[model samples]
Target: MPDFSKLYDDLKRARDEIKLKIHLGSKDAQDEWAELERRWATFENKAELERSAKDVSDAVKILGSELKDAFQRVRKAL
Candidate 1:
């Protein structure tokens, strides 16, 4: 099993740090933040499902991949 907790924390920390540096008044920044929020929500929802999951479903596998991709994108953005 992967260490989802650590990935989640790292992505969140990166997002928060970037949030502090960007101007809220900028539409571009707000759009970027919105994308981050969307990714975070998806990742968090999947993580919750993973906790209660018995067998690893195809959907879960896809979600895991997506979350990892999102994390990488955010990391690169930072």
Candidate 2:
């Protein structure tokens, strides 16, 4: 699974950074941020299992990648 702890930490850092800037972004970005937050929660739960099992599920990988990309888009929007 390539040590998803690193991936989780990196994503958490990015998400935190964006959260501080989101207030200054547009309504659309804020809405997207909200949706991403939901996904993040879902990811967090599955990520732990995957991290522990050392077996990366396709769903978690896709969701994590999606969150990363979405966070980048929101940051650019901001």
Candidate 3:
């Protein structure tokens, strides 16, 4: 199983950096950020309930991929 903490933290850091750099004035960017944040919380809740690192890692991977795409859109909007 991959390290959920490391993976999640890395993604979180990257997302945060992108968010900090962007104005987030566009509706798309705001929506994407909101979705990402919602998913982040859901993944954390799932990890807490399941107590399975692999499951958490998998969930985080999906979220990370979405976050990358979303951030790309946000970058384009900037």
TM-score of each candidate structure, all chains considered together: 0.51, 0.61, 0.47
Q: Candidate 3 — what's its lDDT?
A: 0.80
Kindly list the per-residue Cα lDDT of model 1 for residues 1-78, writing each as its tens digit.
567768877887987888787775589878887897898899888888886683557678999999999999999999
**TM-score of candidate 1 on Cα atoms, chains taken together:** 0.51
Q: Best candidate, TM-score-wise?
A: 2
Candidate 3 lDDT by residue in tens digits, 1-78: 258667777877987897895675688888888898898889778766756666678999999999999999999999
Any residue pairs clashing in model 1, and if so which?
none
Residue 11 Cα positional deviation in candidate 3, in Å, after optimal superposition: 1.7
Query: Order of candidates by TM-score, top first?
Result: 2, 1, 3
Model 2: residues with Cα > 4 Å off, grouped in runs? 52-78
**Candidate 1: which stretches are off by over 4 Å?**
54-78
lDDT of 2: 0.90
Clashing pairs in 2: none
The whole-model lDDT of each prediction reads: 0.81, 0.90, 0.80
Off by over 4 Å in 3: 50-78
